[model samples]
Target: MACVAPSSRASPRRFRLTSTAMMESAPTTRAAITAARARSILRAVSGNLDVPGGEPLGYADPIGKILSFNKLEMNEALPPAQRAKQLGADEYPFFGYPGWERNDAANRRLPHDYMHPPWAGQTCVGHARAVLNAMRAGRPYPVKAAISVASNPLLSLADVRKTYEALSSLDLYVVAEYYLTPSAALADYVFPICTTVETTELWHGTDFCVACPSGIQPLYERRNTYDFWRGLAVRLGQKEHWPWENVEQVWDYCLAPVGLTFQKLVEQNGIFGRREYKRYEKLGFGTPSGKVEIRSSIFEALGCAPLPVYREMVLSPQGDPEIYRQYPLVLITGSRFMPMYHSEWRQIQAAREKRPDPLVTLHPETATKLGLKEGDWTRVSTPKGAIRMRLHISDMVDPRMADADHGWWFPERKEAELFDVFESNANILCPDDSELCSPEIGSWPHTALLCRVEKE
Candidate 1:
């Protein structure tokens, strides 16, 4: 049987309907190819070409607007030399803003008077891996101070030992979070941030926009991110830059270009733009090619492979046969759960009740061989480290593969010590070696790695 989901091929009519929808929505050659592949799966399921007649669907072109408004107007409007100074611009030319000026500009006015940060030829010396390196060496310049917002680098980042050492060595570490995460516990100061539930938000999904109104006022000493930043700006003698005291003032400013306020948008429910497909036919893709680049011109210019490829993991059995003998199972991490978002929501009793503990899913056959049964406490280990989790023996995974949920920490544990974040965090198993990353992007192998599981 195909790996395609059952819902994707539930009925012949449904298959044809979705195929037509996909075709209508596909705006580029790349998208068309993806749509075709999806349709091919449906064709395989239906076993005939007789299925017909589904309405052509169209979405409210939000991405096209956002690209034109935010990127083209606000970002690209900056001086070319200034844009060139954005971090990693020299090393990763594809991600640089200087090249993006060639793209089409948006016609819509912006709501707020937003200004790009004047980076002024400053290098992006503070990327994730680079920051860790700075903390380790203190070479180019001593990075004595650090601020973390809605992040838990120690649990989320690869090489827990290195992260711990780097964080421990920092002279000033401050974190803003709802809970005291492992990374937060190491901080010199931990500020209480208001939960998303207490704040208003505007969601831009690229096809449509929704204005969400705040439900409850912030209680206690809790403050929104903007308030925190604005307060900090005042103390840092940058108060002139932050004119807006609250989210309402900021939102109103942002809505000014469209003549809509946060309150007005909330009254109107939401706004959407007209869907115009084949936009490339008129304005062309925002690329040097003026078309969808099958092979990236940027990559080619950088002397890297222009086309994308799928290669076996560097530490996989196929990649390293010697290591495969000792570590057999294919470990996959970063799988998500609906109740929890990444590393958050663990503190909620209801959410925690739904998923009482961290789990590693394994095939029943694999479990039996390793002397593990359903709900058995097991230790999942890699060459880097090990974490204990309950075995959830199911046929959901292949016999040779194990899938574990990431962002594991106990809210019930002592908050003073960050609730034992290291006990079952999946990132502890990943490595951050340069050689182990992608040739172009430097992405760590978070999902695919070699491992073994045994009864703990």
Candidate 2:
């Protein structure tokens, strides 16, 4: 590991990991993701990012790459001043990758905004930051009024205290969700949203496209995200902007590019398109050079390191020697738990029965050293904050590390306690301090965090 300070922005130091034997063939070998022979891989919602199958070459669905729609670039269409003020975008140019950052056809021709938001293109991290900026004394593009769709920031983003402060500061905050989550409970108005089974959705699988049938009509005034936005737009005299009355009609307009209709898509089950591996050979890569950018020129132009670099955790033992003295044990967090979606289903008894308590796994040896045993409630504390978790004695984690599960909340608790979100929730221990985040898009550390564990 060779420490190189390539840029002032990566970190105080960037650890370059390169095999000594492959140093001579650095460009050709896969030992390091250097600028010479590596391709930039950005997954900005062509679908099949983590699905069963997609193009072997990239994460993008071929339907988006090949038969894309002619959606105009919203930001570029704006005046220069307005375009320059695209919330947290100018400061983090990487955030523009989903908008007009890449020179690729698929990304440039972003078809639909859909359930996604305009300010936050792909990087969901922008969600919290946008609010914080709004609360700041003199930050650009401060969000005064906002509407959140089906996201629980209190359990999702790091630094729950800060997130609460930022959210509470919003002048007009509305939430569109199925249930009143901790975050939604704070909203000025909460609109009931329908589930996936109740709302029609156009799902694009590996190589096929299908319209998901609504199992049942939405129960009593519950609406999908699209309808929510359409309704608001119509009331605001922007009805012409949203022509499609419902999602099915919107899908029909989207399918028109392929001379297909939503009704036909449902009737035929699905339509599969053939995959072509080296389509980049014909269209070239999305970089300015029309090739895979191992050392991204875009990154270089943005005053960032062209190649990958590593930095020690902001609160690790090495980074904070004094703090590490009392807090000797290393804590890892922000990982997903099984049988439940992110921060959801806590109210569902079935999911809770499977994994009842929030768990932090540690090697039995590590547990015993702390005078703790299997299934002991441990108070996991970091410099940022602390949370209580049931300790699970296991060797799945290193003896020196305690691995904590994320998204824990007791819905049975009274709403006055914010459903006891502060307890057992991992995000409470994770802080979104700017120094502890990624340089590209301000994405905070989800794992490799530092902390100590003691019996609660």
Candidate 3:
């Protein structure tokens, strides 16, 4: 090596060493070298090149897109009010009034009236408000006696009847049911109305996957729910009342500020309007500050918790050991299936086939312990009451838990013969205590209960 200045660089000397005659003669070494060189060449090309298989591809499922579009079209046509009514009827049809010929002595024997005289002590939020207004004006509780009944999500006619009985003193009762109680039963006017699907509804569709429109014709006789209220207002002679003539007009009024028109929507057969799929990219949220508030300031301002907190549920199985001893398994009620909406699908033959009768599902171990088999008639009882259903032993359910498919009542069948339970109503088994209502959302406590089952 020559001693050269650092700046005056010289090309590096190449060194080559020839293998010994013995090594060169080895075919295995030559083959290994050849394979190594081939792999190195492949790695270099693959590293720098964008191959077809490695590239990202974008393709939409065509069938899914078509189904989505059809759903949107149906939603746009029906509206929300109609949808809600349909859902209610679809889940539970009012088979209360059979033809006059069928109302013979045999049917009359069942318990038609289950209402108790209205109590003087009970009061609800609505009743309290009325009382306060009366006190302010120096008058007695106006509009006759007030009745406070439990108004919970997924209510059944049996629940309505129970509430009516609890508040028997009242001239009028307010409860949100799919259709008006028949004129024969209710003294007041029956209001047949629409559901969420039949009205102008605005929701955060992104929360539930697709913000697409859904529409379907009302399967049974129905009317716009808002119109019922509007009609009531008109009858009451309220001068500055609801001005809308039809459901479309109501939609126009609601969406005017957002620059949406019902006519345009109808013309387009429903719009799956542009939406920001990625929530974070749209600037935090539509809140005061453009940041996710782990603690909701809005709720705090309204004297509510900033964060979600759980308080022990009233009448919960965890608190009642006696209930568990009598009813060994906990019963969870009310889960949605595709065919039914809450309690409404009984009217549709096709949907009814999906769940012909109410099923009480239990784990295999629990069934074995109880000496019960699938399709065995079992009586499930709570502290309040009990109902008989066909048992379905399944591993899908927990060993300690059971499920009674909610909303199954065939009024056409004699009450005594319907099920071993009285009235054949599930609500009879649920606690009637109003305290079971959710504190935050004002929903009734439907699930979380202890019950026992006996093979019938």
> Each prediction's TM-score against the native?
0.78, 0.81, 0.54
Q: Per-residue lDDT tens digits of candidate 2, residues 1-456?
A: 333232112333233323222322212222222322221232212332222343244323434422222342233444656545556665566665433444343233333211111232443234356557566533655566778888888888888887788788888889999987888888999999999989888885445677788999899879898888889989999777788889888888777766778788788887776555555555544467755565668778776677766666667767777887877777777556789887888889899999999999889898888899988898998877888889888887778788898888888886457888888879888777778777666677666667889898
**Deviation (Å) of 394 in candidate 1:** 0.7
Please give, for residues 1-456, the per-residue lDDT of candidate 3 as tens digits: 122111112222311111122222321223122233333333223431122222111112211121111111222344445433321122111111111112222222322111111111221112222232342342442444332222222235234344434334345644434542221122233334456565454331211212223366544655655565566668898536457666556556544533556665455544443322223233233233533345545445444455555454455445565655766676677656567666565556787678777788899999999999989988887777777788887798878787877766553343333222243346556764436544333344456666788987
For residues 1-456, what per-residue lDDT tens digits would candidate 1 score against the true structure?
A: 122222122466665566665554432223222333345434323432211232212224432232112421233346666554444445444334432332222111112112122221231223456567678788544567889888888777898878888888998999998877888988999998888888888775545566888789877788888888889879999767677788777777766556777898899987776554433344444346644455657567765566654455678766787887888888989788769899988888999889888999999899989888899998999988899898898897888889988999886787435678789999999997867866554557776688999888
Q: Report lDDT per candidate.
A: 0.67, 0.67, 0.44
Best by TM-score: 2
For model 3, the run of ten residues with the poorest summed lDDT: 92-101
Model 1 score (lDDT): 0.67
Model 3 misplacement above 4 A = 1-164, 173-187, 194-222, 257-260, 272-307, 313-318, 414-422, 432-437
**Error of model 2, residue 20, in angstroms:** 14
